[model samples]
Target chain A: MPGHGAAYFGKLAFGLVVMFAILAGLQAAPRRSRKIIIAFFTFLGGLYFALEFFYPAPSGENFLTGYQPLVAGLGAVIGSFAIGLGVFSLVQLHLRTLSRLRPGWGYSIVLLVSFVAMTVFGLMNEYSPNATVIPTVGGLWQSQNAHGMFRFLFSGGLSNLGSATFSIIAFYIASAAYRAFRLRSIEATLLMAAALIVMVGSVSFGTALTAGIHPKLTDGSENPWANLRIENIAQWLLMEVNTPAQRGILFGLTLGLLATSLRYWLSLERGAYFDKEL
Target chain B: MQHASENWWVSGLVVLLSLIIIGKVLSAQRGRVPFIRRIPGLNAIDEAVGRATEMGRPVMMVPGISGLDVVTLQALSIFSYVARAVARFGNKSIMATIDPIVTGVAEETLRDAYADAGRPELFEEGDVRYLTGQQFAFATGVAGILIREKVAASFLFGAFYAESLIFAEVGQQVGAIQVAGTTQTNQIPFLIAACDYVVIGDEFYAASAYLSRDPTLLGSIVGQDYCKLLLLGIILIGIISTSLLTLIHGGPVAHLLHTLVDFLKVK
Candidate 1:
């Protein structure tokens, strides 16, 4: 294990250096490693999950639960860096755009100004304890108000805008379905019929349609088939038919994903991760 | 919620099936094979890229909001093929990735694809850009790219969420030839609504086999279907036996069916 540790650290340093070097090379020199690092990571990620499941735990300690601390720390670090990278990229892009004064350059200027202001206020609130004293640039980092503004801007502005845009789907769906649901051909008719049935069947209206049908203790009097509860019929169709089709498709997809993953992880993917031919 | 013994049986079956598939594919690779069914959506990629090339426009590929998940990586695999085709035909591709890790991989994918096509000089690191981790920000950035660049064809595939509709709508508005696919059941409605060609659920996985028409891939696909058929057969038997027993009121068949169900009962 100690021997592996030395190799591991060496690999880590080598990998990190290679990462920066490759990033630099990407901009300067077009040369790249022949190896599939993405596939390597993908395989390692899969292995982590596989090991977590297949590897049994010893007595007195749980497997995943015990590793929570390590996992959480790593996740936090990764998450922070991701955020930082986004901010950095945004800043750089906007700054360049503003300097060049490209077409619609004003938008970039607005973006940069808003982003910088928000970030400054965010930092101020993080470090500031008191709001009354307007200290130097460093003091703003200590202001609670600044932090509150960042939360408000993020939660109120960006979050709301995103949600509102997403919610517009309701209108889009209604419009699209109306236009496309026209019965022009047999296939279209069949699709419409299926859609209508499935839509009704999944809702409470479908169940209510067959509320008259009762499950009687004595079935000698009348046949249950005569009732033909739509909801029950829908449930039958879903369980007997739709579910099977879905399961089949899901199973095929699962296998495809597995095979594709194996290909990538093993670096067998052609025309990917290397440009030897080129 | 199943018992450990039951889990073992399922696992064993999976391993057995996998081995059989591997063996079959290996054998087929060393020989000729049968014809595989064509997938229209995947077949359209070449024409889509060609149209973009003719117009002197870039092709945009959005791998959805999925990170390095299996579905995302599968999308990446398909993207590799698409990118190579684009590079070969002297077309440009811009991949707007939501995941940094995926962006990195996508960059490599494009790089390798260009290299494969003998056009490494055209590969641009800036093309494989990471937009944002947030779902909407990623969607907005991709939409921005589509509108600003006036990309000719957009390929949306992977695990999309709320932003699926937004992305699809933007692509639609751009008048770009859009081919969208996803396994996300809820988002399928949106994709089906806006995309010119939509790959629903498992159809996304069939891209490689469909596009390449490689026998090994096709054989594996068929093998997968065979497994699915077997599972379906078992479930059908279960349902039929259960229904018949229930209909018959009470008999030996009913008792036998009940016992069988109990014996195979899962949590």
Candidate 2:
């Protein structure tokens, strides 16, 4: 469809009608048949990706290969619209809370105020003619400015608040590490030792402590003795031990993901959501 | 010898994995079912819910801060079982989601679970909430919920980032028994440190199977183990052969092995 035109509106109307019609039809269908319908569509989508991916085409591209972006974009498009649905939910919840004078009604007021402020300032900052770049200051029209409010709200308010929240993690980490690294068990002891080594290895003081231990001799030959250096030991532990351990977990994780994905694509997944009578 | 992403190896592996999983599923339907191993995190969920019931406090679940992906879906699936248990005990279950669709799906899942448990009236509209999509905002919001509601148990299952620790710490402060499960390995340590029980590795993916004890799902988990075994076997052979070939220096067999490995690295 055209981006903007009478034709675009006509096509958009038709699409909406068609979507609603399909939804109504699905809703009206018998319960058992609905499962089959879901299974069929799921299989079709899965088959497309499977063939497009697995088929070693002589031409270097399968027939269904070109639509990959479009398929992915469809997901993005749906997700973008889903944000609206999320906003609506937030608004409804807050509005209801406010109307009922709930215990946290004050927080609801703050939330609604912030939501409206962000959405308005964000839209205006993006589309307003006077919303010039701070340094560049180049645009077609330089009319009224919503840019100051937008910047203040986003950078001065939301970003700083987010940063403050993120900074709190440092304190929490200390608390958690204190609990985890306590000398209670052998495993905890080893974990503490390892954490200590990794932490020290990451600092300049650690490097300074082991600066006398050179990796190379005066004649530019290998110095085997340097392997005992603190930094070197830390590097060895991370590369030789930590990496292999992570890889082992990764192997299991990848295989599990593959199996689960296969179950989903084939519509053979059972239990909870999948098996629930829709 | 060759880049893994430039060949058909992945396709072959995917097909094999699919065959194995589907075969197990069908076999399970035919009366042969596999036994699932013990997962302490899953068992802890029941204890958490029971604790909430006894304390007259609500059970809380955060289905991740991400959109409706496979990870979130898995989290929600686990939550479904949790919801059922809460329903049976006549305790409130609060689910906070960062994704709008997750909130919607979780609401439906909770409703179904309640209906299944013969406690449809226990379901509440305000229980399933959509917090902000922004990361820390959702974290703070959930933390506020934990503090305000004084929940007896907290279930954090999904893809979590830095805010995971925030949840864990807040749950700790409120004296909530926390059970956390995530595929993200980096977050596992923090969860282990703060949570009463931590579900790590593939166990997160295996949660639904553990909870429901569904025959087909159990079979699929078994198949995953078999697939992992096959992978280990291949890796072992490769390592041994490579070591031997290094000493040999040059040979047709070594060259052939190298080519096979390269070709198997699917593009």
Candidate 3:
């Protein structure tokens, strides 16, 4: 970004054209060979990351480490093209719905308008000089600039909608807890007891109830019985019990991820997606 | 993560485990596949598809909000299995993706799946949708689909964050039979509470192999179990050594253990 000029733009354009040509060629290639070719590239990419991680270096950085960012940047650029395809797909669907006056055509209108407004403002905000905060006499027109419009749509509209939608989850949680906390089985009872302890221990009332259970008793002797305090029980459950269970799950999760990666890196996964042809 | 050169002692364990996993995979391919217990969620997803087929409604799948990572890829594999089932029953399947590349890949995956089922026309581009790449926006869009289509079944797989509850709750509201799998431990509780079936932790990864019964995957899972045993052995050894040393309090063996542990630790 710092050294960009005519030469960089030219090279970028040339690289894009080369990439496009290669992709087109791959598309035109035989189906069986295409799978092999794709798998080969996938292996190369995975190998780079794998070695970068596993290979030891005297200076604490492997040879491939420095190229990691560049590779990631290239991947991001290619991914942006996929976004282009997604946009095309979305727009095509909405256009069909609007033309046919589908049942939910009104929602389609809202989507398209928002899409266009956000895209226009977002692009302008990115390319244009920073919009100066203009002192204005009009209240509603205070943020009429590209920055303001984008902020109005993004933070004010999208953010609020998202937050409100997410807020509904608290109610869902309450309902779910009501159903899950029933004393139906041993597991359920244990869960309920733990939940009750955690809930009570987290609050002031529970602590107040155990206020007399001081770490040191009135006679100035160590009070081992203080461990029975509600807060202490809750702290033990969270730190000693809950954390260990979470770690246990994480251990399995990490190993599972390792196995899945090996399956993909080796192209050993068998399915229509992976073994469509050869 | 420190470089292996800086922490070769720790890296040695990782490398050894990886070799075992690879070995198991190769061994499985040679007809020595290990057994994987039934993942109840697999049947649930299949049954959900069948229910949707009976109801004449589409089955919706949200493959998390991540990009083209291993998590999303596995989610896509499961989606492919669901698509194949849907195609077989002359039912429709919908996929809402939060990543553009995943949307493209999901489209191709479903197209191939439908073709495999000899129902190429059933694979509509409209069904494999590219919802907004934004997380909450995708949630809102997917919620709309769940409510409007009243899909009989919804499958939520992959790494979900805060929006996990939104999808499950909405599907529940629509009386959709939901099968959710996620490696996010925190999200698992919410999923378990709301969905009819939920896969937690590493079980999320096993969902694919259970559905496809691929020998390679079963072997990899067995290798993972072996690695788990290896970890348990190491942990037990560490606990015993530390306890004995604590009791003895200062000896050559304790000193050696301390040195070895310090060496393995990140500098």
Candidate 4:
């Protein structure tokens, strides 16, 4: 047998050759043939990871370590490239719209411009490790050094924007809760009650509000309810009621995911996954 | 691990089975394929699109910040269906995405839906916009769109994290009728708090099948449930056997049970 490195290189070359041949064949094939090939690749690409993960490896004296993982990684890489190809196609289509000066093509122009700008900045930053930047303005991103520039763009600018965007949800939650939590029916009432308890139990003030309420039977600190800690109640709910229910939901989700994956892997999924013949 | 069977044969089998199923579906399309019942959350699609049209407002569709993963693809499928409806209604649909790849797919889906509806003229390429890939950047962009566009209805579906609350909240703030779904358990509470209708966990997967009423898809879903039952049985067996082994005196059965449990446990 050849050495491991030689074998690995030989295999890689063979794979690359096969891929190129398939691509060439796909290009030459008729429409139906192409579609079938695409579907075949899609199925292989989709389920390879799940199979490696969920299906147990055969037990033997000597372990087969590298092969399954390599296959899984290659499958993932190919699948990812397929998605990338789709994105590239989309960008190309939009670029064509801008070139043709299609109506409302200005938006396409903005998109292309932003996309190109981000790509350039991102790539340049990646390639140039020790580039220097001079501080210009705003306390937020004034630093001119390379590290400073990276921090400004990735951490300061991107992170803050993300955080600020997410923070608004707090206001929206209050509003939604106000509208949705009305005691309109029995189920609604129960839901609202649960919501109220959970929400109150999560906050610090809620603990203080209930802290003075003494347990009926005990005065010792060892008493479960004596401290009347809201956080404690919340933890109890999460650990006792919430964990099991969540686990059950998770159990159902795992099965659903597995089944869906299996059907796809086995080529049994119909409807949305399978395109209807036009 | 890497047998020719693992590479070519497994792939071939998967392809063959899938093609056979697809062929069966196509052949069966001629006759009355048994009707699959509509899921209630899916029933709201028409109403949601119609609400936007009647109000002359845009519909906000956020396909989570997840990348071009399976969950995101599932979200895109639903978005395509919804976009088609909006196109038919002559209503606007706004899609905000974190992944450039997903943005690309969503745009294609929207454009295709419009083209399919014979209203390609109504499609706005920029309507399917790329927000930043950063978790919060996408969330904020969605929130801004919700607030600025005064969206009549919001559809937030896909993989999400803490940003789920942010998106749903923005929809709520705009007073938009919201329908949210995701597989993320951590984000479900946030969605439940803010969205009008929620499809949690596997329900999200069932959305397209429910809306389309395709029996083949419904059968796949039932098949999925059966698989879940199998998983449940496995879990029960594992737990019971492990427990019994721990309780009983040492024996070959006990040793076997211990081995099984140990093998299954991940470090």
Candidate that scores best on lDDT: 3
Question: Candidate 2, B44: how far from true, in Å?
Answer: 0.6
Which candidate number has the best TM-score?
3
Q: Give the Å shift of residue B152 in candidate 2.
A: 1.8
lDDT string for model 3 (B115-230, tens) is 98899998887988898877888888999999888889999999899999889988998999999999889898889888999888888888777877788888888899999999
Candidate 4 lDDT, A171-215, residue by residue in tens: 766776776688888977987876677789888787777877666
lDDT of each: 0.70, 0.84, 0.86, 0.69
lDDT of 1: 0.70
True contacts kept of each: 0.28, 0.55, 0.74, 0.33
DockQ of each: 0.36, 0.52, 0.70, 0.26
Writing each residue's lDDT as its tens digit, candidate 1 over A80-183 gives 44555655655666667678887667867766776776667666656662353333467456434555667667787778977876677776677667756779
lDDT of 2 by residue, B1-267 (tens): 122234556656766876887788788878898888799889988889999999999999998887887788889889989999999999998999898778778888899899999999999888898888889989999999999999999999999988999999999989999999887888988999999999888888888888888887888888888888888888887677667767765679878777766654434
Q: Highest DockQ among the candidates is held by which one? A: 3
A best-first ranking of the candidates according to their DockQ comes to 3, 2, 1, 4
lDDT of 3 at B267: 60
Candidate 4, position A69, lDDT: 70
- Chain B TM-score of every predicted model: 0.91, 0.94, 0.95, 0.81
Alpha-carbon RMSD, each predicted model: 6.4, 4.3, 2.7, 7.9
Taken in order, the candidates have interface RMSDs of 3.8, 3.3, 1.6, 6.1
Window of ten residues with lowest summed lDDT in model 4 chain B: B1-10
